[model samples]
Target: MTKTLLIGGNSAIACALKKNSDREFISLSRSEGSLDLDGDLNELDSIADIDGLVYFPGTINLKPFAMLKEDDFVNDFSVNVLGAVKVLKKVINQLKEADGASVVFISSVAANLGLPYHASISAAKSALEGMSKALAAEYAAAKVCFNVVAPSLTNTPLAGNLLKTERQVEGNEERNPMKQIGSPEQVATTIDFLLNAHKNWITGQVFPVDGGMSNLK
Candidate 1:
């Protein structure tokens, strides 16, 4: 069985991915133990070879331009960008050892689409996308693939505040070309595809699972 490391594995999408795939998943979540994103990641030392990795840590800090503070951007970047960098540094060797490994990072449609109250998250996710592409180029020779999955607003715990009421949900749905909200399964399916390292020749790409929100109307 292919072993996949799921950073922040307790997330809704990660759980959905685990349920839908036959690959073995090893999760490290802060809610479950001492996995702190801003701190040391010594927990990865004992792990052996891993064929795939998915970084699921993210934030949805929404506030007006005026209301946004420096700390807000720092916090969002810490979770969305720095955490992925830290985890990747720790696990790159394991992935390279597999000879055919894939790494997936979760981004947001807000990174490309200019949405209100998404400045901080957008900045962080945009940085993440750039980093993923760069890593894809750097690791291509080693057969280690790196890609990103950028999804729009989904009904997950991390987005509960924005989707708390029917009016809010409806407004969000109406904004999308599909006139619907994304689901964990929808995004998970995309991540699963990218996780299949040796099966596909795709790399240095950002697959948007945002129901056409990033491109269409």
Candidate 2:
């Protein structure tokens, strides 16, 4: 009977969550359901009964610092960070009314570690991770939990270019101690765990679902 709102469902992570999650899932995206990122999120009103929410929009603009443009950072920040904030802002009342609702944000390993051509997205993702923790702490009293997931290279459409080349994919898979890139389904499992009653007491945490990419060499 638990209703959940997934802000971005076109992505593999959201799809995976849809298949794996036990709660009622309402997918919201710019593609299918509703994704008016720069527009009003009034469409979200349909899911007034949602007890959990997850934001899955991301920008994979990996450009070198010198080659990066102002618009690139703006786009990255808007989608990766500000966009989520906007949606949540509009729907905060629903979450508060639900009481003890959980919020999840998807981040990348680049948020913490450094990588060439990852300037814009990395910074934006870092802001997301930090903001999630801050909100988690502040909203804990209201019984609303917030958390971020920082995963390594996952085989998703968002990173299609990076995973297209044979060498790029191979190198990335090797970079993780697990010797493989992550899958959307796997990350979805983690997201599912965090958003469920199983993670009731945990909050203000950034979970690295990376294939040991953040820690291992």
Candidate 3:
């Protein structure tokens, strides 16, 4: 079985992935503030290498551009970008040792489309998408694949506001072309497919797993 590294594995999406993935998975979190990336990746390295890596840190702070705080951008940058870079730097060798592996980044559809109160996340996710493509190209020669999964509003922990009230949930469901809200399991399925060898030829791609929200409307 392939070994995997899942960062921020306590989120709703992470929870689902953890439950479903049959691979040997290592879970990481800074919830207790012990996951300081600069000093160490783990208290003890149980696995010498990783065949798959998925970074799941994200923020759902949606506010009009004028209302967004400066720190908001910093927070998003630290978690979404720097955190992944640190982990990849630490595990790149192990990934190489694995001969060929995959790196997947979670991105938001806001990166490509304009919407109300999505400026902060849009900018950050856009940067992430660009980074993924660059890394994909640079890593291809080594048989490593890197890809981005950009999804629209999904019913996950990060999207609590959309699912808070019954009416809100129903409204969001109707807003999508599928007439239903997307689920973490649905998103995880895509990630699983991307990491498998069947997708060996696929990289430097951004898949919008938005149930047609990004294209239909």
lDDT of each: 0.87, 0.83, 0.80
TM-score of each: 0.95, 0.93, 0.91
Ranking by lDDT: 1, 2, 3
Q: Roughly what TM-score does model 2 have, to 2 decimal places? A: 0.93
Per-candidate alpha-carbon RMSD to the true structure: 2.0, 2.2, 2.2
Badly placed stretches (over 4 Å) of model 2 are 31-35, 38-40, 197-199
Alpha-carbon deviation at 45 in model 1, angstroms: 1.2
Tens-digit lDDT string for candidate 1 (1-217): 5589999889999999999988889898865323365453676787786889999988888899899999989888888888888888888888888869999999999998898888998999999999999999999998889899999989889889889999999999999999999999999999999998556988899999988988999
Whose lDDT is higher: candidate 1's or candidate 2's? 1
Structural RMSD, model 3: 2.2
Top candidate on lDDT is: 1
Per-residue lDDT of candidate 3, residues 143-199 (tens digit): 788888988788886788768999998888888888888888989888887877425
Candidate 3 displacement at residue 129 in angstroms: 0.7
lDDT of 2 by residue, 1-217 (tens): 6688887877898998888767788876775323356553777756566678899988788767999999888888888888898988877887777757889999999999988889898989999988988888788877888988889889998789888899999998778899898999999998998896324688888889998888887
- TM-score of structure candidate 1: 0.95
